[model samples]
Target: MKLLNLQRRMARAVMTPLTHSERMRTVAPDGRSMRAVASQIIKPNDRLTSFERLEIYNRQYWFRVLSAFAEDFPGVRAVLGGRRFDAMAKAYLIDCPSQSFTLRNLGSRLVSWLQKHPSRAGERQNLAVDMARLEWADIEAFDGLREPSLKPEDLAGVNPAKLRLRSQPYISLLALRYPVDDLLLEVRKDSDDLDVASNAFNERHKRKRVGAVAKLNPSAIFLAVHRLDEDVYFRRLDREEFAILSALQAGKPLSAAIESALRGSLIAVADRAAHVEKWFHTWAALGWFCRLEKSPKNEKAASRQ
Candidate 1:
């Protein structure tokens, strides 16, 4: 084989997902022999055979990839416990190997993957999905791109009827079936406390404390995850507020977004009008909207005026 082709084959061999024992099997179910493959490509070191050398890279590759994935989804790990989380992480890696240049993208498909394989998630499937969503939102909120925020003066002459709002690219809207934000916060708190106490204490006591954190409770939740002052925050929103913001994020004009918000049964007709201005002011101060863009129809109407 050509050197470049040989290199490619060796890379695939090391990256092929398999246990150490499976790696030694001859003509295994997958129709590839690690021993035969290694002999063809790798030369033995003084003490290590070609297969032994290849095995080192294989184990290390999986360990590093799995570690990065676990770091990104710490809340999921906490929810699923160590053993199950490890198994699921291994399976997930095999199914959705690292295709992106950046490890941050590793969890991009995790939420959908979990949904498709709910049986692997055991009884807390929905909760696992929620946690994954929340964590991914946080990741995006922290590193996602953003346009310049609209300042208060930028709205000076804007007409509410025709004002189309653009959401900050960093803003993420999520409607979850569980209070995963609260659960994540509690889990993080326990983790922080454990780290602090670990230095002065024993392992058994630390494990007990970690086990004592509050259990997750299911609740309908609407959340806006966004960045403010270089920090990511999770804000709980009313259903009506979420509806309005989501519509605005979807590129609806202010008038239409209000209409969408009012469509929710939770907000009374009388209360809707009163809340519109208040919500707008709160959103503006929070830097949720990037800038107001005049719709073409509105521009034409104003031109005729």
Candidate 2:
């Protein structure tokens, strides 16, 4: 076989899903016999046959990917429990195989996947999905790009009608049904304080943890998951605050963002302006807003001075 064809064939055999025990499947996903496929692609060594040699790659690939996936979504795993979460992770990987060079993008489709396949989450589908979103946002905030935030003086004498502002690239605006923030916080704290590995899978321990977490009823709230210095923090947002920040992030000018923020707002007309002003002051202090960058043409013109 040509080199490209040989590589393609090897990849097919390697990416094939594993059996429940983490061993290579006898049958390939395409219905071909893995033994026959392995014999054709690999050579027998002194001790290991072609099938065994190929099995090593198959087992290692799945193990590495599964470990990476588990690390990325420990919160999701806690919600679904280990065995169920393992099965769901396997199924999800089969549906959406790793498409990126790095494993960091492994759970990129996880939230939507959980949304579509609620059965995988058992009784805590919505809660599991929310936890997934929060965990993913945590990853994003950790390394996301940040522009130089504006100083309080930067907004002085500015025209709100035409001044364009941008939210930090790391800010993740979330509208969720459950108070998953607290749950995730507890999960993180426990992971630090206790090994909890045995407790995570122990039915009694899982039940106690799950029951405590599950008692929180569905209440809609807005949140911003953002990074400060090197640590990530979750801050709750008022409905109007969320609306205005969302609009600003979508590239609206400040005036338009404030206007849209007021459309369905219940804040009294007299107090609306004060709220927006106060919100802006607080937001600017947090270094969430950055001035829009100048275009290359404008930069060149300004540099000529």
Candidate 3:
């Protein structure tokens, strides 16, 4: 019984989420400092000291997480430059240390944090925040659950008035003041010669255009962030489409959501009638929606059968 209890305690210490205070401790309750602990675990052929061995894990941990952040916030990275970007990255990690087992979950809170504390490391904080959101959505769309598409036939003849439709988990709509999307795309296609000044074009100040203005009226965007055939895409949406999807996301019924969308513009009427059909068709073609909810009539029929 004593041996079992000791084994369980050690397991908990290894697997349980460590507190910041706990992490700061060089040694654990097992009388093993990180250096000694790491050295003890090292294979026989390994020649490094416990400190050096542990340093490898520490270095790789920071590297992998930072790289993921950089990939997720390319536009922000462009504006901030390498030196400032790394500083902001370090600050972010320190403030909200990784809580999940996977590194991908590390940046989930970063955008909201940036919005609250924008002046980090001399970066244009709000712009970086927006870019971070865009990038985060990109990461999520790539990694989130993929549902099977609903066939057009499945939705056909179904009363939109009665059905409650849900947007696929992967699609996200974002409204932004700046053209971070276009700028990021341009930078990705172009060479390392992308100048920070060009990226932050100043039309009023007489600077030549590198890409269209990052800022837009209303300072928001309607975007569809989703994956099709294993490739993630960020497609911009018209106001009507955005409204329709937003309502659906809020769990409004299909008829009500369509009606709300129509109030925004007359296109809402046609779009409402055609939107589900078109979207489902494309969704089916792309394999975005994974499961379909059967109507009451179908459920009854299946029950009787």
Candidate that would win on TM-score: 2
Error of 2 at 70 (Å): 0.6
lDDT of 3 by residue, 1-305 (tens): 37787555434334322234323236654565655445455443457565554455555566667788777666676666666788788778767777888878888898788877767834356566667878888888887776666665655555566556666788777877666676666556543434544533432222112213433333666677788777888778767777767887787766788678768585645556676567545645765443447767434433553
List the lowest-lDDT window of 10 residues for candidate 1. 205-214
- In candidate 2, clashing pairs total 0
TM-score of each: 0.87, 0.90, 0.67
Candidate 3: residue 238 lDDT (0-100) = 69
Query: For candidate 1, what is the total of clashing residue pairs?
Result: 0
1 versus 2: better TM-score goes to: 2
Clashing pairs in 2: none
Instruction: Identify the runs in model 2 with alpha carbons over 4 angstroms from their true place.
Output: 195-206, 295-305
The superposed Cα distance between candidate 3 and the true structure at residue 13, in angstroms, equals: 16
Whole-structure CA lDDT of model 2: 0.85
lDDT of 1 by residue, 67-132 (tens): 999989878887677778888998898889888999989999999999999987788788889889
Judge candidate 1 against the unseen true structure and give its global Cα lDDT, from 0 to 1.
0.79
